[model samples]
Target chain A: MTRTLLGVVIAAFVVLRVWIWRRRRATGHERVRARWGPFAGDVGLVAGREMRERFRGKVFRVGTLLILAVVAAAIVIPTLNSGKAQPQQVGVVGALSAPLRAIVVASATSAGATVHFVPEPDRAAADRDLRSGRLDLAIVDGRELIVDKPPGPTGTSATAQFVRAVSNDLGVAEAVQAAHLSAAQASALAAARALPLQSLQAATTKGAVHTTSLIGLVLVFVMLSQYNTWILIGVMEEKSSRVIEVLLAAVRPIRLLTGKVVGIGLVAFAQATLIVAFSVALAQGVGSDLLHGTAPVLLASTFAWLVLGYAFYCWVYAAAGSLVERQDQVQSLAFPLSLPIVFGYIMALTAAGSGSASELFKVLAYLPPTAPFAMPVLVGFGTVTWWEFLASAAISIVCTVGMARLATGIYRRAILRTGRRVHLREVFSRAAG
Target chain B: MASLLELVGLRRRFGAITALDDLSFSVPGGQVVGFLGPNGAGKTTTMRAVFGLTDLNAGKVSWNGAAVGPAERRRFGYMPEERGLYPGMLVGEQLEYLGRLHRMSGTDAQIASKMWLERLGVGDRARSKVEALSHGNQQRVQLAAALVHGPELLVLDEPLAGLDPAGIDTIGGVLVEQARSGCCVLFSSHQLDQVEDLCESVTIIDHGRLVVSGRVDDLATTGPRRLVVRVEGDRDASWAGGIAGLMISEVNGGEARLVLDGDVDSDLVLRVAMGAGRVTKFVFERRRLSEVFREALG
Candidate 1:
């Protein structure tokens, strides 16, 4: 009887708490309305609607999952491959002293690799082993090195650097033994350092930075295209469905458009943040050096450019969306609209792949359409300064403002003129008249 | 005195075509006004202009004696002829969202949405997606969205275009109720019969110009009255055509309808019919608003 009474009391307490919570929520809504006035309130309402719709949409959920899978693959694949990397195997012909083997091992260790040296009777046996995949490299009489492929001048591969270092050390040891130098002299000779390289021009090539830039470029491309298309298709759907008419009745055209862009933009940014956070956390967990050197700056720049790129394209796509009344028309319109984006992406990818920006790419970096791609690549290459990035971003922003105004005008005029797809010329003519 | 809603000298041009030419009209508070016109007669354009959707070359739309702007428009509910709601959105949630857009608090919007859904007879379908509802049900949801905010003024373009008889009656009742509660209602429709039943007043336009506008009774009464007479004896009434001021508009089965000249009296037609034979039925009646519209357009 006492337990039953306690249960009843608890249930009543729970009901009371729920009632209080609902009341608080109701008052909170009222407070928002009172604080923001009708214009902001309407904008917020429209934005809230967009956000809610997107959150509940299957397309958004599926697209986010797909992109995240791609991102995970991009980050995890290389780390897994590197974790399973094989040690470099060297086959030595003729006599190889213990000192020489020690030097090779030390060089390999310094270059962040493992080496296994196998002795052979002669050059023929060493060459046979190297050709038959029993060895990665063959050293003949401790003087000549043979490999399947020659290293580039940049010495980008750790194995190539290790081989060079080992060969140099062997040469010094041979000369010292030939001179019959005292132990102290030999020690001093071994302690000598190689000359530092001073170049007349700045070095533009960095393996890690180049890879990060390429990845960043691809990320920016995928995200800008995806989110901008969302804005486009979303606007088209709303316009075709005549929801814009209902929305326009409550808020001004500009406010409605602004709310839509902002709402979708926030969704895109949130997804990007999730992907980045996941990539960072995963990279840390796997102890990958893929994101080494200026990684934070690269990430920040990539995000900034993603925003600028999206801002520049979203308005254009939305305005185009307003001109059409059918889903099929969206496809016809999207191709033309996406031309610049695709072009910019390809150009940036080329520059990133070649590890240097072309003069034309440098020029494109200042233009809003291509800057979102080119500028970030330049930043990663260490070819652009902070002010230069700022200048390019400012230019893009100014252009975006102009585009936004023009797009708003187009949207307001064309969104209501349904039935047939409206011509751009017609919209302009109507505006002028 | 300033009217509840007023449009004065509204002139709008699109390229070489003028959609509205010096169009002017007003709706008094607590009255339902019908906007009638032939196709491409600028009814939709004028309605769009009221919501400031169309740019005017020269004109003004004022509400409550103040220039209509976004603020005033926010309080004004509008249903465009192309009835649209997000297909993926649930009916009740969509209504509440629209209510919020019109500045209703969330809780108020929720209650109003529920009340309208129930009132519109779609209470159980509130959680259903709009596209999942039948066309008639979708129409009801559309109306609910418009009324969810309890708008001060309602403008609906072609509100009953594709509705069945029952749907039409339901919408008419709701609109009448709204007007009775002091919400000025303006609706456009091609259905003249529905308009006659619902509207207290009407404005008809053709070629972007106002053809006729006034109280339904007044507009019907302004035109010449017709006289109908039937004789008990089997006789033709075609002779009534020969009357100096009476033009026989129709003659069939001993009954004749005479269209009297402006100065002619219906008593003369009745006397003429009485001389021909024992008069069985004589009645004087004003034209219907539909006939008035046709004649005005002609």
Candidate 2:
């Protein structure tokens, strides 16, 4: 995962820079407006700076890519070795001829079991796997079966059912032999009975893993939150240091703050893109079958949501950062701001795990801070229509604009009024006043 | 022609602390005005109030006959005591960016930044990160950033702070050059001698109230007229009791300190001192601004 993040860092610098150059050259006011966007160039610059700085950070960049790599491994490893671990993998002891072995497979099926003659190599691995809770049960001598001792009620009953079936089979066969049944009759009975118990159940397919882009989205949101917070803190640091007073004389606060946020956001986008591209290329190159079925939507949503989520959260953090002039105050303040993010993330995770969006999760999708994470999860779940995605995007964009206004107001109101952590009350009231 | 910047009845409150209480002052163009005070004297607070960084509880700041809003303030430049420049950004980029913020376009910003960097003798360090610059050089970068837009008014709070003699000369020369170019420069400094050299006018505030303000020489000289006389020939002569127009106050080291009548000239006092003894030096004491400040606050 950490290795995968390397690509994002490289891609962010190259691709985002290209994007910026393209933005600069874009034509008319309307044309420029369309391509460069109203705030994207500025926002991109900030995000880009942040992405570069953070992706270069040993902890965040590496941790996220590591997580993605782990996810890829989970999706791939199981599917690649598909046909090996099933209940049909039967364990047997004692010397039996090849034809008798076929008969035992028939008999086990007759008793409602499909047997795979693992022949020792698998039995050794199965023994280890059983201890690790992998296999359902191990059959020895086609009679003495070993099952994992599951806690509480379920384990004993299942064991009893297996034992009773094997014993009943032996007893019925013995009774039939005493009544003078021929070998041909027993063979006919076993084969006909084996027909009644076919056991090949398909597990959850990898196709479903592609649909789980929420994890990817959460990654983007978390990164956006962290990067945006960095921007906020950066602004506050300047203001508290009394630098803003001088800066105000040179440029408007709105422009300065906007430029910073855009710069950092662009950097972040680059880092994320590089990591995504790196992982994809690496996965493809390695023939890592785990990534073979991983959906592009998951990666795409992650990148898109990262940019969108940052647009929404950066202003809030920057605004929040402006409220306090001192570094010590940042930690206490960062917590309250992060609460919505945490709540949104938790709700999104719950929805992802259920493979469905609940009504409550839908509410989270509309919230600006949460939407970047939650809405993407909804899209991944096939739970949202295109209109709904568009609606969420629009709402998020609106929320971002509103947040920028609110934050800028809060920042401008409180940044110069330093000395202690100015109460949230003071910030609110001053803004209102 | 009248003044570049004016603050009328500026008042600010931080909870119970009235940082500035109805403060008012003006700085005309083509001169440097000294903003003087000790710690807690609202020097910085007043500077902030003028820039419109702090909300005016009840007051106004006007620049060139128009109210100083955020846009209006963009035409002015300030160097706050906080000493801030983006640490991670390149020196050239930061300067150009600030210039742009002041409404300078790309060509103008680039030109100003390049010229200023060259003037500072730091043109080679343009691509260097601000963090990599020396403390004095960083301060130079900050000054450059402030002036890159050629603002009409420059408010520099503690402009001479944290500098060695060489740094001071460079800044002082720059400030004088700007003032000579008809820019109004209002700066606060603890170095009274520096202020004496640089500022034509001085405003001294204490405890959120204006104590004294006027042309520096006028304010210092406009108080009571007092003279110091050194007499070589006589120590016991009645230098104190009998000289007309000489309100002598203290006598020591064969010299008499006296206050002169308003219409009195130096010759009258010189004649009296001469009658007492052969007068070598007769100097009038212009009460140092520092002494005036002490008298106001202490």
Candidate 3:
């Protein structure tokens, strides 16, 4: 009886707590409305609606998942391949000396490979194994190295590197042995180091640095393309659906448009943050060298440029979106809008791969349309000064403001005038007059 | 003082077309006014101008003798000519969102949304997406969206255009109830009979100019009275020509419909009709609202 009474009390308490919690949750928007005031309240309502719709939308969920899957594949595939190493087959013909065998094993290790010596009954057997692809390399007695193909001057294949290492080390060891050097003299020759390379200018864009910049460029291009197009379609949908008339009656056109872009921009930022976080965590967890030695500044610059790029292009797409009357028109309009982005992306990619920023690339860095791609490459290359970077950002920001104002004006005028496509030239002339 | 929504000399031009030309009207609190006009008569333009959706080339919109701005507009609920709601959004949620946009508190908005939906006969369809509802139900939701915040001034353009009779009655009742609750209601519609039944007063515009503005009864009664008489013998138009203020507007067989201008004596007209022929049927009636609309536009 006492336990039953206790259970009843607990159940009642639980219900009461739930009711209170729900009551608070119900009033949360009221709190936000009070805090945000009237102007922000209107904008916030619009933005909140947009955010909820987009987040619940199937396209966003599926698209985000697809992107993450692709990113995971790109990171994991190479790591999976690198984790397993195949042993190099070395055919031993005739008599093998311990010293020569030790030399061959050391050369294999230096070439980042493992060697397994396979005893050959005769040179003919060794030649057969080589022809059958069973043996990567063959040693004839202890005097010569044999192979199906000779390593080229700049060949970087695993077998080519192994053969070259073996030949070079074997030649040096044989020469040292023939000189009959004492232990100390042989040790001194083994300990000799190559001269350190020095240059008047720093070589910053090399190896992984270049790879990082290329990845950053791809990210910026992708995010700019994806999110800006979202703003475009979103605006177009509101206009085409005739919802803009009802919305414009409640709030100013500028606020509604601002809310839309801001909402979509938040979604973009969230998706981007998730991808970036996932990539970093996955890369680190797998001990992959993909993001190894990536500079924090490079990551920060990439994200900064991403924001700048979005800010500059979102307004343009929004303006274009208001002008178009149909979904089919979106494609024709979007294709021309994407040309500058594609151009900058291609050029930045080329510069990143070559590890050199050309004069044209430098010029493009100053231009807002291409700067998002080119500026990051320059930053990764350590060629652009801080002031120059800030200057480019400033230019982009100023241009964005002007573009936003113009786009807002166009949206206000064209949003309500339906039935036909609005011409940009007409909007511009109207504004001018 | 009763709050009044006043549109004074509103003029707007769309390129070469003048959509609203010196259009002026006033809707006082606690009254439902009908905005009647033909196509391109600037009715929609005038309503759009009130909400600041269209740029006015001249004049201003004032509320209670004060200039109306965004703050004032927020208090005004508007249903555009083209009915629109986010088709994917739930009807209830859309209303709540609109309520919040109009500056209603969250809790207030929720309660009001539920109340309006129930009142609109779509209470059960609150969870349903707008696209899933029938056209009549969607129209109810559109009206609910406009009224969710309990706006002080309600402006609806063609709120009755697409509704069935039952829908028309329900919506018409709700609008009347809103006005009785001291909310100013101004709606545009082409249904003259419904306007006559529902509206307290009407403003009729033609070619962007105000053609008639007065109470429905006054507008209907202040016009020429129609006197119809059917006699045994043929009644020619010559009998009505003898009366100074009476003219035969229509003649069919033995019947003649005369228009009595000003204060023409009905007894003298009855006597004249008796003299022409043995009176069979005789009745004097006020002009219908449709006749007033036609004559006003003309």
Candidate 4:
């Protein structure tokens, strides 16, 4: 009876706690709802239109497919290469003296290596392989054990032992020739214990680093370029179509702009997220190791910088769109506006190649224009401190606000200026007035 | 009728060209006002200024006796001269999108959209994309978008410009219906006959300034009415001119047509026609609005 009473009390307490939690959650949700309020009718209207238009647009559909395919390749190729075995090609440089060849092959077998005896005609090629880190060791002249600089006797011990046995057989044969030893006697001497020699390392770790960084480069570039251009072209199209005019009529220019930045930022994120998830699935399913040694923080930082970069650059593109009245003007305007995107991309590529952030890159990490490129690199190489990242993020946020406000001012003044391209001074002066 | 919209001294300039010079007009509720001008005569500029699609360089626009901001302008529908409509969108769907822009929810917008499509004679075209629709059907969709939210006033720039006879008739009926529903309908057109046929009132501008504005027939006549006489003349054309205030403007097929001075009485034209021959017809031109329009403006 006492145990039953305790269980009942505990059940009641748990229920009470859950009820309080739900109530608080509800009230907190209500507060946020009241705080954020409902968006003006035009914002949703424009976003819906943008969503429909882009979803149906040929450029968007086809471009998305191509990018998805590329992401799939990046993931699957490496996973497939992960299983490739380093051929245990041990090159025997001299005329094989058949028994010596057998010992080298046997040692390679114990080491789980695949042995190759180079023909005398291909001696030069075998030497080149040894230098190039492909061939493990060269059993030269049935005596000399040649390899790339030995790994503190762990490598040469096997090669040294194999060579000494072959030399001992030759010594025994010479003794028999002076006092004439038989082939059986020479064979016994060859079978005895030989000196320690090391074997060369297998090509196990080759191409792993090469493929990983390649994937990173391609992934970072395609994502940044595709989404950033989306911002530029999307804004330009909206402006030229005079859709913004109707949109601004309903909401304040700032709200309208904010909603657009948020909406498309979400869309870019969704695209990146899908590609990442799909590629990860494809890699795991296909058994590829292309992404080996890559930092997870690199993916996280890439997404973070994507958002920051889009926020910082979206206002500029929107402002540029307001400056032009015609479609042709948009093409010319995009190149100049896109220089920062291009420069940042190159800088990020260089950082990836060097595997470290430079001073200029560190400074760029703080600037809103370049942070998208620099932040990802810092995160990848483990070079950035938390405070540095926070500073960069804070700067980007502040700049986004300022740029949005400035853009609103210009768009308000310039969107209606349709007869000619509006000069910056005109938009500024008109705003002031 | 109460004034639905009023523009006071709406002046604007584009570099060296003065697009609107002290332009002003008022559109009262349920009134169909024809805005008439030649090309580059500032008709579109004035309409755009009233719609707030262009910033007023030097004037104010009042809606329902209150100053209109951008928010108020959203409630006012405007059909620009260029006929802006997204081409690839479906006809019914585009109207719904535009309706939502003016604050209708999706389902409500769709309901309104269907009703408008039926009303515009495009019920069969509801599912067709705008680019797939004929140009005339696209125009109907454009009109539907402009009217979907039931705005209190509509500013149409050359709604009749590129229509077939049937299309012109259909749109004319639509404009009249809009006016009858207590919405102020202000549309610009170069078709004088259409202006005379559809508008109760009209404003004509030439060279960036007001030429005349008032009741269409009244504004077309600048002076007192004159008697127009026709007579079958066999003998002397000189005898027709002998009557005071009677001048022969044309003579053909043994018939003489004469314009009388505004002060001349009808009996004098009868007397003058008797001198020409046996007066087969003695009728005065019934102030043909076209003649009056030509006499005053042309």
Each prediction's DockQ?
A: 0.41, 0.36, 0.41, 0.18
**How far is A251's C-alpha from truth in model 2 (Å)?**
2.6
Chain B TM-score for candidate 2? 0.82
Model 1, residue B135: distance off in Å is 2.1
Candidate numbers, best lDDT first, in rank order: 3, 1, 2, 4
Across residues B230-290, which tens digit of lDDT does each residue of candidate 4 receive?
4554634566666776667556665555666777777866775686667776655444445
User: What is candidate 1's DockQ?
Assistant: 0.41
The segments of candidate 1 whose C-alpha lies over 4 angstroms from its true place after superposition are A1-40, A85-201, A430-433, B1-3, B229-244, B248-257, B262-281
Alpha carbon deviation, residue A48, candidate 4 (Å): 1.7
lDDT by residue for model 1 (A18-106), tens? 75475447532223232122335655766666776776678878987887787677777776755645678998887767777787887
Give the Å shift of residue A104 in candidate 1.
7.6
How does each model score on lDDT? Answer: 0.82, 0.70, 0.83, 0.67
For model 4, the DockQ equals 0.18
lDDT of 2 by residue, B1-298 (tens): 6456878898887777888898988889999889988899999878877676677788888887778887777778889888887777667767766775576765577778878887876777877888899988888888898789998888898878888798889889999999989999999989988888888888889878898888878877875687888888666547646756666666787777777778877886788777876788789898566655665566
Tens digits of lDDT, candidate 2, A259-351: 778767765665566556655665555455424333565566556777778888888888788778767788878888888888888887777
Docking quality tier of candidate 4?
Answer: incorrect
Clashes of each: 0, 38, 0, 20
Descending-DockQ candidate ranking: 3, 1, 2, 4
Query: How many angstroms is residue B167 displaced in model 4 relative to the true structure, after the best TM-score fit?
Result: 0.7
When sorted by TM-score, best at the front, the candidate numbers are 3, 1, 4, 2
- Any idea what lDDT model 2 has? 0.70
Best by DockQ: 3
Query: What TM-score does each prediction get for chain A alone?
Result: 0.73, 0.64, 0.80, 0.63
Q: Per model, how much of the real contact set is kept?
A: 0.57, 0.43, 0.46, 0.22
